[model samples]
Target chain A: MNPSNNNIETQDDIGTTGHEWDGITELNYPCPRWWVWIFLGTIVWAVGYWYIYPAWPVISGDSERGGTKGVMEWTQYKQLEESQSEIFSRRAENLEKLQNTSTKDVMDMPELYEFAVVGGKSAFKENCAQCHGSGGGGAKGYPNLNDDDWLWGGSLKELSKTIKYGIRSDHKNTRNSVMPPLAAVMGKDSVTKVSRYVAGLSKGSSSTAEGAKEYKQMCSACHGVNGEGNRIFGAPKLSDGIWLYGKGDEQQIESQIKSPQHGVMPAWIDRLGEDTIKQLVVYVYSLGGGE
Target chain B: MLEKHKKLEKNSILLLIFIIITISIGGLIEIVPLFRLETTIEPVKGIRPYTPLELAGQDVYIREGCYGCHSQQIRALRDEVERYGHYSLAAESMYDHPFQWGSKRTGPDLARVGGKYSDSWHVQHMINPQEYVPESIMPSYSHMATSKASLDDIGSHLEALRVTGVPYTDSMIENAYTDAMAQANEGEANTKDGLLKRYGKNTIVRDFDGKAGFVSELDAIISYLQVLGTMADLKDYNPDVVE
Candidate 1:
């Protein structure tokens, strides 16, 4: 059979392209009417969307007129602004109360105290939980908020002050102190004897005569005579079980005495603002550690 | 129209050519706007190029796949702004050859982490993330502290970055190794002064790893992490104006 003759006719009485393989004919069918209408509808919707949003770029390249400015004048930033404004307006009264009231007096009002605690809890999670544990259990150097040991006094007022200015931060009002590496100043052997004496001070064990003599000469100025610790110096009471840097072990104490790693807490005043700080102060004070 | 369609479908080479043209239209629409990228990024002050040490740290960050868990880009949302300070600007990542504007955030955003914590805190967090943050699922990178940072190839690294439109000066490229060493060991008067002279007075010159003498990978990575979103000063930017 001639290849040209195969395109002449088909067995079935239907429209065909005359393209057949092994006597199988092909029929050309139009697209479904509903599907075609829906497709057209989508194109119309797309065009309408283009007109209603920043869509097609213009040739001019000017940002203002670069793309089609919809009548809505909407942006992601604008949406965020609106939502934030709504939130601020809703909490305006409570926020004002939080700002005006003293951190210590905040606990007097039940509702305000609850609000502050809730706010502070979230703020703590975002800001404080990174260095301090999620439960405020404190890290190796970072202070534990749940313990009764006071590094820089655990009172609500003191907590507020510490949180505001921070300890050894760049903030001018920061609670500044320097625990000089005693090894450099008092010789290595004295530091060891002093470490042993300081470790024994909290454990109800009496220091050796040699250790006691060394402690008075080098450590009494900041740590106090009996290792009671001075708040002004930001020194910890050596008699307590709470060790800021490590587990109150002999080696850890010796290492600390050799080269003290002064813990630095950033002043949250610039970052978190006063109201949040007050709330954080109240929350931290309520954590069973406040003096 | 039917005959034309039938003829077009029958010709494979013609169909291929038409397909190419159709796809090219989409490709051009997507790619052409990048040619005018300068217009896209807002003008912001204090967005300087990364110092050699920070650049090396950034290389370490990329190598360790830190971007897999953390995102650098903070969207202009109320919650994000409240938590992560200001929203990230395109100008901040302008000098980055392949920017670290990651999408996922398994860990917190590192956009404004600089100056939030001290160098020792970063060192501790890097060595064992769970030590400070007990709930943290991040893996320990204790090995980074022990590993010494290779400073010999730092000059070449600066040259490579300079080729990708980073404004690294001839002197900066030449003194990249020393500058990195100086930034890590700020106690050394000569190197510290040299670093300040080359990188600018604002350069953070200190032992980032808390270990005074030796420069380690931990130091480089901590430097990079610390300076994540601190470069671009967004003080004058009024978000309301854009809105």
Candidate 2:
């Protein structure tokens, strides 16, 4: 085929190849010089990439060793360790301070308190926020950390002990208590009467509900004569009206009297170490409800 | 060379063969490594098969589509490691017939939720997630508390898992029903030793759902959740060894 014999002309005037089907001709469009170079460059780059990274599996005798461990020998765990070490180095001063100071003493040091609060906030979100509200607002069954109504005392030492060992937890030294179902031992009528009297105490109405005698005999061992809760037994202050289960209505009170629900908090000492627990104590104490 | 190419293009069979060969290079690169999975998975100690109760609970987990919200695999990123304990290991889910290393995280990663909360917390959380976690979008599984776990098919389930390399022994399969019951009724003394003998001593035995008459679906699921990433003691884990 001759160039002069063509009726159509391309913009670049590039010649067509001698291949044709029907009336159409195959144009000899050369790829851009830069693109052709880049195409070949990527092939070379791929070989280098494979060499630098764990790319191909290697079979040695009967076993298959995962891959060539790369020239950089980069493992994800190593990267994680590197990043974590960076964080650790940055917080080394605070971490040391946190370790040295007791949880109670952490409050006195402004710098330490700030460090602990920050650390404890993140730790609480990870661990405690699920049960205890994100802002320390207690849920229906869970106790509120923002109020002075503490079931097992709210002093820094008390809070620290509770946080460390946990209430009704599996920990060997867990603050354990059980309010046995009174309906079985005492008659159901007596339980209802006692519940009504207890409910009346929180309402500020000194009603002589018939269960006052039963309350003194059975419940007063843990709950005081005036319904003040005992920290030793972890009994709630009935007079304060801060209910842990349901609203302290007559029915709710009666249900609790029948079969009390015991809440369990896992021991955090095994999980969050003493330093973290100390930090948590400072953070909790700072939450306004701390005694 | 141009004329030779024209001849090659004209022959469809030859073109097809070349296309196959070209595609196979990419295909082989992606697939052949999977055949050597033994090498790819690092050897880690203390990764054991799920006990009968745990396996049953895992079935409940699958049935409920818990993986839709919760991811079991924690990535190798720093933030994820700090939040969800150690990054997940392949050996951890080796026994998982269909692994639950989910992609979407509607809920937090459950890779290391084991022993994080008490059994009672799990019971409450499962009954009503919003009651414990007000911000949680998780649905209530309160019905599970009432429904009894199916003990009849437990042995057959173990046998099926055995077919997929779970290493459930014949005796384990035989006592699967009893073992599931024993796990839920921890107070029963006779079945305790047998369960311990079968599934290591570290196996947690308790009335997980705080109910006793029959093993509830709640018990199975709680048992599964309680043992999620507690298998391996990561302190002894050496990530340097790729074996």
Candidate 3:
């Protein structure tokens, strides 16, 4: 090593500290080289990222040139639209046929039946499932669509009629018969006798004298002479043990005969198309009673 | 004074930013429509809608606010299965616009209650709530038992409902002809064809005996009641594989 006169011949092992603090202490040190590189890279990437996506709140409308449209211009709303379209395409073919075909033709297509089943389940959920459960099972006063016993006939045709022309609703051309209030027609006391006699019908017992006459004139019109229910009227068989609201004990029957009952189903023609209703009929029919 | 105040402001500003960011994250998570799973069923499956009359009964149920006490859905709990039936399937309420998974257990669930009672029974119960069940919280809807309807419409209106998605077909529309004949027998001259043209050919009526005309909207409503919970096809609907 050279003596103090030659500057290039210095032999210090460590690098220089730009500033000296208090004699021998040093103040400066370079950060690690890798760290410096990464830091710079991140800053650069951020600038590019900001340019590409809508990372910032947008204030401009569609007219701005470079005012918005963060380079890619992608949006969640658009992504949702695209995904929905993809799902819709799978349904489109079936739905198209449905919209075009008459419901009768729709029924003939067993494959369409399969499609209808799939479609009907969801439609039923949206349209009929509120009163009828997801599976067409009903509640205390509500009738189950999945059962073999139908107040109305269980045939697809019969089911369809019921759906199209709802009962007791304000719908135009609604199904019409009204149970005259027994109290309205028969004096209050007669109601008791009639209800009891009507109760006897379920047991296949003869109606009391007053009941026999009232049954012939009033009840037999819908309930049938033998007390078997008219599926057409949706009147239940008197004999069946299955009670919707309750069974025909003396008071129960008296209350019923005194006042005819009203149950209501909303119309679905405008809500669910005819084919879908038919499909629901098929689905319901397929559930318990096909015969 | 300016320097001291600026220092204080800086400290508060940083605190505010941290709080805002934390709250924003929490808000976002809560806003998401957290999808939950109960049971599994294919999204697009088929089953029949209730008939017009049966559908009418459902309308009656709703009109009377039966949904308040009775739920059509049976939960997956053991008590529900025992009290109602098998667990209420998602498939059961698929067609319902507003599912009737009742909020309370005031009355038993009627998920599978169609044909569970005779028409007269329903009639009686509606007339006097306590007549059948010694202890019932329901108020008798005796008004429904009479022709004095709180609401109207049973056929064409149902056609409108059919548009909602309960399933109607052309043959069913033709049945309107037989239905019209039945209506005639019931003392109305309207033919199914005439009704069909107006309600559109898809109108469905379940009164197979063609005794439709005599059926007031009330009869139709009762018909709706008659068809509840009848969809028990173990073969078509294999419970084991429904999921």
Candidate 4:
């Protein structure tokens, strides 16, 4: 059979190109007029989009940096800058208040406090919510924000300082402290005894006479005589049930004493500006545990 | 036009040739510009090659398909800039062999995740992501904490990266294994000092996995995560001044 024999004519006098298959003819219909028009319209739109946005690589000239910069000079960076400007304008008043007012004054002013809390909540979700929970409940190593138990003081001033400089961060003014690994210095037996004594403080369990002696000699300097902890040294109170690194169990306490995990919080002063940091301070304070 | 199309369609060889030419045009347009990649990437300060340990961690990250969920690219958007610090620059990922500019963000963008959380936080988060972020849908990688990272192939890995334009020196390649060990254990004074000298003064030398006496996969991963977007000096970066 001829290759073109399948091209056949139809009954309606709408001639097909002499093609047929099993008593049927294929209709060689013209492309839909609307569809063709829309296709052409899309091409036009694309050309317009290219003209208005960075498109096409440079072929010859050094002046053509990489791509053809559109007539409007629109870029993702420029778009971001414009949006940031708009946001800045909107928050100008609140930002100004945050910058000027003291940490105490921020809490006193209801409107400013509300503004800070709202802004800080979103900021915390973005910055601190990964390790510290969305609600600031905190994980094993991370400090819970909602509790009164603060390794550093819970006061607004202390929180502001902590947020600005961070704990053991690279920041110059970072709240630096190291709970030295006592297992090496105190020996395994003494470290275990101290761990037991520290754990028993919170539970009100009677510490072994040997453990009590070891606790006074090895742990008391920074952890305090009564195990109340010293905020100046960034030590957690042993008497408090709250443990930053682990749960207050025998194994957990022993592991912590043996090889202490020092938490490092990145400084927000460099990342988030002073105004935002102040707002964060107020927000953290409003988490219902601040002094 | 219909007659010309019919003629071309009838000749298989001619159609094949035309198809090859059409495909080549697209291929040339895409591949040719890569030759001028140096000019295309903006020159930026503080963008250094990854250390041996960080490189090992990056390998582990890829192995675990961390990029499947976490994006290394922070797009120049107001919200992204506000949340994830500065928008990610092309130069920031210049040394990345297979870039981690992921499309899907099941988790947050990890471009600026370095130094954001503590080492212990990272360790705990990796061991169990939900333990920290209650709402996080991320899977646990607790095995990494116990598993010992193989340092035997690190020197070769460095050499391979060097061949692919990572600027890993002969000295760096030679000391790659020792440097990986040193970076994880601060007690190794000689090797730790050597690591700092080779990499930089800013190289964080400590037991990353919280467990002493062993350098686990957890240490490498933590080291890698801790230095994600911290390499680039964004303080001096002027977004308005396009290089």
Best by DockQ: 2
Relative to the true structure, how large is the alpha-carbon lDDT of every model?
0.82, 0.86, 0.58, 0.84
Clash count of each predicted structure: 0, 1, 118, 6
Estimate TM-scores for all models.
Answer: 0.89, 0.87, 0.44, 0.86
Off by over 4 Å in 2: A1-36, A61-65, B1-32, B186-189, B241-243
Error of 4 at A182 (Å): 3.6
Ranking by DockQ: 2, 4, 1, 3
Model 4 chain B: lowest-lDDT 10 consecutive positions: B35-44
lDDT of 4: 0.84
Score candidate 2 by lDDT. Answer: 0.86
Sorted by TM-score, highest first, which candidate order results?
A: 1, 2, 4, 3
Best by TM-score: 1
Candidate 4 residues B1-243, lDDT tens each? Answer: 767877888899999999999999999999987766665566568888888889889989999999999999999888788878888889999899899999999988999888788887788778777777777899999999999886779999989988889888999999998999999993356888888898888888878887888888999999999889988878787755555
Q: What is the TM-score (0 to 1) of candidate 4?
A: 0.86
Model 1 clash tally? 0
- Clashing pairs for model 4 are A6-A19, A6-A20, A7-A18, A7-A19, A8-A18, A8-A19
Top-lDDT candidate index: 2
Better of 2 and 3 by DockQ: 2
- The residue-level lDDT of candidate 2 at A143 comes to 91
TM-score of candidate 1 relative to the true fold: 0.89
- DockQ for model 4 equals 0.58
lDDT of model 3, residue B122: 57
